[model samples]
Target: MTGIKAPSKRQLNNYLYDRRREKFGRAAIYLDELEKWIFDGTTIPDDENEVFVFSYHVIEAEEPSFRLALSTKKLLNIVCSTDILHIDATYKLIWQGFPVLVLGTTDKNRKFHPLYLGVSTNERQEDFQMILMALKKRFCLYLIT
Candidate 1:
């Protein structure tokens, strides 16, 4: 009675789970909002729209995986300045169990700076190739010259 009452831990956990379920159940809405902001120039970075759908795969008419690549002019310059690029993957960041792929490079002082980040259904060769193709297409001129 003296202290403010808070929901029990189990109750709190259930509430969080329910909220997550509701959000995931409406994934389309979330994607739509994100696309609207990006394409409508509301979320442009450095006066440029740098977010791209690097890969999208659907099976049986259901989208299983969607990989979005985030980039910016500054990030791209850092990427091109570094001679070595490092690609790494992490898991369990989301409840869906998709792997988050990170593409980064080190600066002259050996500090790692991430350039592109994506989440994919699996670590298939094709998935990686798709990412590589997108990066190549975007930076081919910078890389060549």
Candidate 2:
């Protein structure tokens, strides 16, 4: 053999998937470390990365309930400059089959740009309310500079 064999695309995908699982954890329960970090009120934003965790509620119980909202400063600014906020939820995209709530705004052209993403243990009115409350909280805690 004169040349080294190259890994297949599937091999690359599996490698990436394994790496992702390792880095992010295999399940929602595996998120304890990162969750604890954010729950400790330690999330900060800078020039390189814009992701921010604005609001979260972690309830300890037989079946722990976790609700979190995530967004960026730029997205918040975009949300403010636009009208017609769109909010919706979808299920089964993440572990524990939690519903991921989405927030965005519509432009004059009716294009939807994503603003915030949230996850709740259940898709109930209360869950939605908490998520919105979390979104509201962002303004008070984090001011655009």
Candidate 3:
């Protein structure tokens, strides 16, 4: 009888995990490298190309502050078309121990539509300016008109 042994359960699981390693296998990649993927504004493509890190502003210093902002095409449309800006920072609930900044617009009905979710390593005026400037840089002409 010709015999070919099938892979064990553990071997199959290991094979699947190895295939998924590029995205989720943290053990194989450095934390800083992973942070770069999450924090840097690299054009990661998908079917809809919806979620991505669009703004990544790093202040060069002895201790750098990394600021990141994420948005979608739909959200940018909302941001450019709307005028009622509602920016708020909620600190109690921290995302990776950093306060999350919310940028959105409120309609006449007071319904909120979040356009950008930004996070900075430091809480300072410059941090606020950086995120606002990032947004302004992208939609300055439209916002002005």
Clashing pairs in 3: none
Cα-based lDDT at residue 50, candidate 3: 70
Which of the numbered candidates is closest to the native, going by highest lDDT?
2
Off by over 4 Å in 2: 1-28, 40-42
- Tens-place lDDT per residue, model 2, 49-118, is 3787777877777787778888777777675566588898876466457778888988888888998888
Two-way lDDT contest, 2 vs 3, winner: 2
Indicate the TM-score of model 1.
0.61
lDDT of 1 by residue, 1-145 (tens): 7797989999999898889888766433444555554355324344333654433333323553455565655566566566788887877454245678889987778888788776666788877887778777765433322
The alpha-carbon RMSD values of the candidates against the true structure, listed in the order shown, are 5.3, 5.0, 6.8
lDDT of all predictions: 0.63, 0.74, 0.72
Tell me, by TM-score, which candidate is best: 2
lDDT of 1 at 102: 89
Candidate 1 lDDT: 0.63
* 1 against 2, candidate with superior lDDT: 2
Write the number of the candidate with greater TM-score, choosing between 1 and 2: 2
| Candidate 1 vs 3: which has more TM-score | 3
Report how far residue 123 has shifted in candidate 1, in Å.
Answer: 0.7
lDDT of 3 at 16: 88
Candidate 3 per-residue C-alpha lDDT over 27-91 given as tens digits, one digit per residue, 9 for 90 to 100: 44334764777755457444233777767766556775677887775576677778788877778
